[model samples]
Target: MTTSSSPLTHFDGQGQAHMVDVAAKAATHRIAVAQGRIVMMPVTLALILAGNAKKGDVLGVARIAAIMAAKKTSDLIPLCHPLALTRVAIEFVASPEDSAGVASLIDGETGHVSCTATVETVGPTGVEMEALTAVNIALLTIYDMCKAVDRGMTITEVKLLEKHGGKSGSFVNP
Candidate 1:
């Protein structure tokens, strides 16, 4: 297990959270992927699928929100270094079951919606936080647009799936 004093290179001497000093680190291409899920009622899912959510196109707005969030990561997250994002992608996949929010795009059943955000950058620091923020904002946008139909919607499974670049090399969830 990684310890607090493992010479991780990002720690402050006092052990309090501190931004990593990347002054000497070489600039490199970096990418990070994050995923999350939102669950809601079948009718709510139908409304979303049919583009009848009343709040306009849910996916279109959510995608824009995610991209904006990725670019404004430092503004939203304190202490996060502002880095130029090379690219960002956020997409939603509806579940395929009647009891779920959306079973399939072709079927009328309601199942869950899965969201994934990938962030890429060529910088000293990684884009993990940007990717995560994009996923979160997308999920939040989904909630905001659909709350009128399903107040009990649940957002879950927000997690980092993979990371590439930086001194640590690469990482992927086992």
Candidate 2:
């Protein structure tokens, strides 16, 4: 785990929010990985897996949304600096069993669809926000596509799993 004693960089001396300046910071290879999961009814998950969603290609469209979200992170986040991302990768995993290999029965027969997004850029600022945003958008896209069938679906545990580069060095969630 990485801990920083430094104060929040987005606030000025007067306590006003502002974007941090990265003009003098050296550009380095930056990578960030984020993950999240959406839980839905087992039947809903089966529908998605069988490519029977009314909106069509739930995972495929979510993948594209994740990539687009990574590229547009700065636009969505006020203090984020626009980055020239080198790569954006998205992965989806649908599992009926939990990590322990036992059926994850929650709220009466549920299934989990996990999204992992890896965003990379060569820039002064880290791409952590971009990666996190990608994961969120991807999960939201899935929810949007399946809401009609599974309105009770929940999106949870969205977070940055790890990040590398910039003056902060590296960080991994413990």
Per-residue alpha-carbon lDDT of model 1 for 1-174, expressed as tens digits? Answer: 244664755566656668778899999999999999998877777788778989999989999999999999999988899999989998888766455544344544446788999999999999999999999999999999999889989999999999999899999977
Deviation (Å) of 5 in candidate 1? 3.8
Residues 89-165, model 2: lDDT tens digits: 99998888557544455667689899999999998999999999999999999999999998999999999999999
Residue pairs in candidate 1 whose N, alpha carbon or C atoms collide under 3 angstroms:
95-102, 95-103, 96-103, 97-103, 100-110, 100-111, 101-110, 101-111, 102-110, 102-111
Model number with the top lDDT: 2
RMSD of each: 4.4, 5.3
Question: Which lDDT value does model 1 have at 78?
Answer: 81
Where in model 2 is the C-alpha error above 4 Å? 1-6, 97-107
Q: Please, what is the TM-score per model? A: 0.87, 0.90
In candidate 1, which residue ranges exceed 4 Å CA deviation?
Answer: 1-11, 97-110
